[model samples]
Target: MSTTQPQHRSVIDAITAPRDSRVAFSVEFMPPRDDAAEQRMWDAASTFHDLGAAFASVTYGAGGTTRERTGRIARRLSQHPLTTLVHLTLVEHSAAQLESILKDYASLGLTNLLALRGDPPGDPLGEWVPTEGGLNYAIDLIRLTKSIEECRDFTIGVASFPEGHYRAENLEADTHWTLEKLRAGAEFSITQMFFDVEHFLRLRDRLAAADPVHGVKPVIPGLMPITSLRSARRQVELSGSSLPSSLERRLRSAKTDEHVRAVGIEVTSEMAERLIDEGVEDLHFMTMNFARATQEVLHNLGMAPKWQAAA
Candidate 1:
C-alpha cells in the first residue's frame, strides 16, 4: 500500500530548535520486571517530566513478557502532556494481534510507537517467530502497521544501529536493512546505544551518501551512561556497542557506587555536550530503570528542570 507521510510535527524539529543547535535530548525508559523495579519506572517518568524531555519512550521486554506493563506505562506517561513513544515487537504476533494493539493504543490516546523485531528468547538470539499471523521483522511490522487507518495517527519510529546490528554481516547489510524500514513506512528511528560519537557520525554520513528517498529517517543517537562495571559489560554484550578505554578505566578504578556514578555522569555529560556541539539531531538516554543518574547527567548539562523554563 502507498501511504503518504503523516502530517505530525517531525521529531527533528524538536531536536533542532534554534536555541539548541546541539543534539536534542530524549530518554528511553523501560518497564521494570518486578514491582520494585516498576516503582522505579514511575519515578523515572516523573524525572523525565522534570527534565523537559524532548520525548520519552517505553521498551518491550526480552520476549515481550512485559507487554502489558509496556502498554500501561505508555498510556500513563502519554497522559502527562509530554511526548510518549512505546516500543513494540512483531516476532510473535499475528496481523490480528497487531491490529488489536493498534486499536487499543488509539483508544488510550497514545499516538507514537517504536517498531522493533525485539530480542529473541532462545540460544541463538534473533530466533524470531511469526506467531502464526505476526510479522517476522521490523520492516514487515511497519508495513502491517500502516495498513490500518488508526495507524495514520501513530508516529511510527524504528530502531537503527550505529555499530551495526549484531545479525548484520557488515555495515552495508545494516544500511540496506534500515533503508527497507523507511520504505516500509517508519517515520524516524532511534539507534541502539553507542559510546563512540564517531560511529554515529560515520553512519549518518553513510546514510546521507546513500540518499534514499525517506533518507535514513531521523537517526537519533542512543546514549547510555556507564553506571556500573557489570552494567556496562552487559550492555556491550547485548548491543555490541564498543566501550572506550577511558570509560573502562574509570569503571575499573571505581570503589563505590558513588564513585562509579560520579565518573559516569562526568563522562556521559561530556559526551552529551559534545554530541550537541557536533550537530547531532537528538540524544536518546537509555535508563536501565533508574532516574538519579539520568537526572544527574541532564542537570550537569543545564537541561534539567526543563519545565521551569517552560513555566
Candidate 2:
C-alpha cells in the first residue's frame, strides 16, 4: 500500500511575502511548567493570534529538559490561528530520539522549526558537552532535520547573536558560525535579545559584506521589553548581552511598576521605530508569556489589529 504526506507550506515564505508591504511581526513563547502556567501561555497565544502575529515560536528548554512540554505546546499552538514554530536542539537526546520528535511534529502538520545547540542545563556558561549519540553544532541538527523524510518540507530557523554568542571566540567567529548555519539550510534567523539597535545593524552589515548573496537571509531582531528591572537584569546576565547604560538608568530610576512599564514601552517603541527606519523587514518580540507589553509596543508603532483599536 502507498501512503501520502500532507503538502507543507514554508514559514519563511509566509513571513516574507508582502502583506500590503507592511513590516512583519512575530512573538516567542517558552514552555510552561504547570497547568496554571500553561493556561497563561494559551491566553497569551490567543492574544497574539488576535493581534495578527505573522508567526509564533515556542522555545526549547536548556539541555532539552522541557522536551515534552515544548512538544505538547507546539502541537497545540500549531492548531491555533497563527503558524507555530517549534524549537529543536541537540542537548541531551540521542539521534534516534531527535528523529522521533521530528516525526511527532510532522504528524501534527508542523512545518516550521528553530534549530539550536541548546545550553548546558546546570550552567549555561559552563563547559559544553555533546550527548553520546546526539549532534553537536546547530548546523548538524539543521542537516538532520532536513534528512528526515517527514520533515523534508520544514522551514528551519536558527539563532543568531547580534552581540556575539557568549562562548564564541570573537565577533568575527560568531558571524562566521551564523553564516555556516544559513548555508547549511536554515531559511532565516532570529537574534538574541539586544538593547542596542546599532548592534543588530552592525551584525546585518557584516553578514551582508561577508557573503553578499546567501548572507541576505532575514535576520529578525529580537526584543524583550523591561517589564521588571530584576527580570531585565537576569535576562541580560543569561544572554550575555550588555544593557545600555541609559536604559538601565531609566529602569533603575523608575520607582513604581507603572513607571517602569511606561519606560519599557517607550524605549522599545523608540528602538522599533529606528529599526523600521533602517529597513528591518520584521520584528520578533520575546513575549515572555505576557502579551500586554508586546501588544502596547505594537500599538505604539500603529501595527495593532483593528479589534484592539476598537477595544
Candidate 3:
C-alpha cells in the first residue's frame, strides 16, 4: 500500500472535540529489529489502517537502543494517514544528541512527541544513571522540547503509571510528578499498561481529583493483549510487577497452548468491554508490531473490519 500525508492536528485537539460519541481506540508500535520484522510491522499497520485507528505511536526504544530506527519509522508513519506520535526519551543520550534528534524530527515535518524518562537500558528495573549533560526527568524533557524552536509548538504528551511508578515513593508522589508534567506543557498523557480496569479507573479519577482542569485533559490507557502465555509472562516480568494470582493461575492451568491464548484473549476482551462501559475517551492498544491480538479484542467488542476480505 502507498502512503499519503494528510493535514495533521494534535491528539489533544482531536480528542477534546471528538467527531462522535463513540469511544475511540488508538495504537502503539515498537521498532522492528530486522527486515522480516519490519514487514510484519507494516502488515499490521495495513490492518489497522483498514480498521481506522484513531492515532498511532512510534517510540524510543528501551534505553534509547532503537533511537535511529524509531525516528526513521516515525517519519514514515507520519506520511501515512495515521496521526503518529514519536516518543522522545531522556535516557542515556547527551543534550546535544537529543537536540539534533529533535531538530531532525522537526525538519522531517513531525508535529507530535511523547516525552519520557526511559528506563535503564540493560534492565528496566536497574539503576537509572542519567547521561552527564542529559535531563534527569520527563518534565525537564517536556520543557526542553517546548524551548526548542521547531518543537516548541508541537503537541506533546507524557507517560503515566496507574500502579504508581516503580521507583516512586508513593502513589501521591507519582500523581504529583504527572501533574508537574502537565503544568510543564504536556497536552495529554498516556498510561503504562495495567490489567485491572479498576486500576485504570482509579488513576483516571485520581488525576481528575488532583487537578480539576488540566488533569482532566485526555488520558489514554495503553495495554497489550496477551497473544500467548509466554508473551504474557514476559510482559509481566518486564513490567517489574507480578500478575494477579488469578490470571497467573488461569494461564498456568491451560491444558494446551491454544487454550492459553484463548484465555488471554477472552480476559482482555472482557476488560476492554469494562473500559468502554466506563466511557473512556480512548483505548490505546500496544500492538507490539502485530495486529491479530488487538484485532481480536476489538472484534470481541463488536468493532470488526473487513481487512481479510478487502485485502
Candidate 4:
C-alpha cells in the first residue's frame, strides 16, 4: 500500500521570501543525552514555536557518534510546526551507510540537511582521518547526495567560518573551501558561531569580493548567546574562534548566574541589532537546548514573533 508523503520547505526559499520584518531568525538544537534533556529540548521547541524561526536544525555529535540519537530527534521534531533540518557528517561511516541514512531521511520527509565533515571524537582538535570508502570533505558528501535521485531533491547546506576554520592556512583559503562546497551543490551556508559582529561582516564582504559569481550563497550568521563566560570561552576555543575581549571582560565582571545571563542577553541583543541594521536576512541562534536567552534577545530587538509561512 502506498501513502502520501508530507511536503517540505526549502531554506533557500525560506530565507529569500518576503517578510513583514526585514530580518528573520532560526535555531539550532543539539541531540539530547537523556530523557530529561529530551524533555528540555521539546520544551524549548514549544517555547520557540511562536518565535518564528525560519527553520530548526539538529546538530550531530563529534565523529557522527550521535547518529542514531540525532535521527530520532529529527524524527520527533518533524511533527512540530517548525521545519527540522538534519545534520549529516562523514566522520566514521562508509559510503553505503551514508546512503542508507540519506534514504531514511527522505522517507521521513526531512529533506533539508546540513553537510559537515565533523570533528574528531576523542579530541576535537585531534587530527582527522577519513574512513575507507567514506567521503573526505563536506563537498564530497554534497556531490554524492545530489547524485542520488531520491536525495537529489534534498536541500543541502554546509558550514562556514568567519574567522577561518583552524585547519585552513588563511582566511582566503577558508573562503575558497566554502566556495567549493557551495559550487558542489550546497544550496546555502551557515557560519560557525562567533561573538564579534565584525567577523561576520568581514566574512560576508569577503565572499562577495572574492567570487562575484559562484561564491555567494544565502549565508546565515550563527550566534550563541553567552550564558556563562567560562562555557562560552571553551566553546569558542573549540570552534577555533576568539571571544571579543571587551565582551569577555563584561562577562567576567558579572557576579551571579542571573547577572551573567542578563549580560548575555544584552550583548546578544546588541549584536543582533547591529546585524539587522546591516541588512542581514537571517540570524541563527545556537540555543544550548534553552529558550530564555534567545527569547529575551529577540524581545530586546523588538522582534514580534509570528508563525512564518515556510517558503
Would you estimate the TM-scores of all the predictions?
A: 0.86, 0.92, 0.93, 0.92
Candidate 3 Cα errors over 4 Å, as ranges:
16-21, 62-65, 306-311
Cα lDDT listed for each candidate: 0.73, 0.84, 0.81, 0.83
Candidate 2 TM-score over all chains jointly: 0.92
Query: Which residue pairs clash within candidate 2?
Result: none
RMSD of 2: 4.3
* Span of ten consecutive residues with least summed lDDT in model 1: 1-10
Q: Model 1, 1-311: lDDT tens per residue?
A: 11222223435555555554234677887777878888877667666655556777788754454766776676666565456677888655677877898888777766678888777656425554567766778887787778788877577889888888888999998988888887777878888888877888888777767865676467888888777778888888777677888778877898898798778878888888887787767788998867767777777878664223213
**Candidate 4 stretches greater than 4 Å from native:** 1-7, 62-65, 304-311
Q: Better model by TM-score, 2 or 3?
A: 3
Cα displacement (Å) at residue 48, model 2 = 1.1
lDDT of 1: 0.73
Using lDDT, give the best candidate's number: 2
Which 10 successive residues of model 4 have the least lDDT summed?
A: 1-10
Which residue segments of model 2 deviate by more than 4 Å? Answer: 1-8, 62-65, 305-311
Backbone clashes, each candidate:
5, 0, 0, 0
CA-only RMSD, every prediction: 5.7, 4.3, 2.1, 4.5
Q: What global local distance difference test value does model 2 have?
A: 0.84
User: What would the per-residue lDDT of candidate 3 be over residues 89-179, giving only the tens digit for each residue?
Assistant: 8877888888888888788767788989888878888998999998898888888788899888889899998888889899899889899
Looking at model 4, residue 143 earns an lDDT score of 84
